[model samples]
Target: MRWIAHIIVNAVLLLALAGYFQSIHLSGIGAALVASFLLSVLNIVVKPVLILLTLPVTVLTFGLFLFVINAITLWLTSWLMGDLFTIDGFGAALFASLAISLFHMVIDAISNND
Candidate 1:
């Protein structure tokens, strides 16, 4: 199902983030899985709300503010899933978001279309 693919992609993204960013800590596959779930939820809910609230700044910055939105989601996921995962600081969160986004892009490319 699409939802399964969704979760798998998110898990892979989280794994890639953990590998790429030293400040992100995932104890094991289990922790990465849990972190992926929280990150997906944060992306689905919190990200849109933050984007809407920061629309003016986002527009002014030519969409660069989306990076901040993404970082906030990373930080939020870290906070909500602290028992399972950990991120050092805003800089780490920012890099994690970037790494995750890039990983997601690669996964999406390889998945079956439509």
Candidate 2:
């Protein structure tokens, strides 16, 4: 259903990130899928709490701190997946998070139009 499509889009975005960044690596489509699923889960379960905890900092930064939160989530996903999904450093995770966010926004916009 819609959830499956969202996961597949996320996997595709992960593969695209791997193709664009030397520091980002995905073992295969399976790894990308797993990483995407884990990322989604973490975003759902951990992101809200993180945002709540960091609300003051996020407000001070004009909402830019959300990018840091996204990068942390990405790094966590890489850590959970171990070698299968690797982000070399915080820089790479930040860039990957930006790219993934952009792609997801575009995809969501397109889907919403239909």
For model 2, state the Cα shift of residue 62 in Å: 2.1
**Model 1 poorest ten-residue lDDT run:** 105-114
lDDT of each: 0.79, 0.93
Predicted candidate 1 versus true structure: per-residue lDDT over 2-102, tens digit per residue:
87677777777677777877888777787777777777788788888899999999999999788878988878878887756788999988877677677
Whole-model lDDT, candidate 1? 0.79
Candidate 2 error regions (>4 Å): none
Clash count, predicted structure 1: 0
Cα error, candidate 2, residue 87 (Å): 0.2
Q: Provide the TM-score for each candidate, comma-separated.
A: 0.84, 0.93
Compared with the true structure, model 1 gives a TM-score of: 0.84
> Model 2's lDDT to the true fold?
0.93
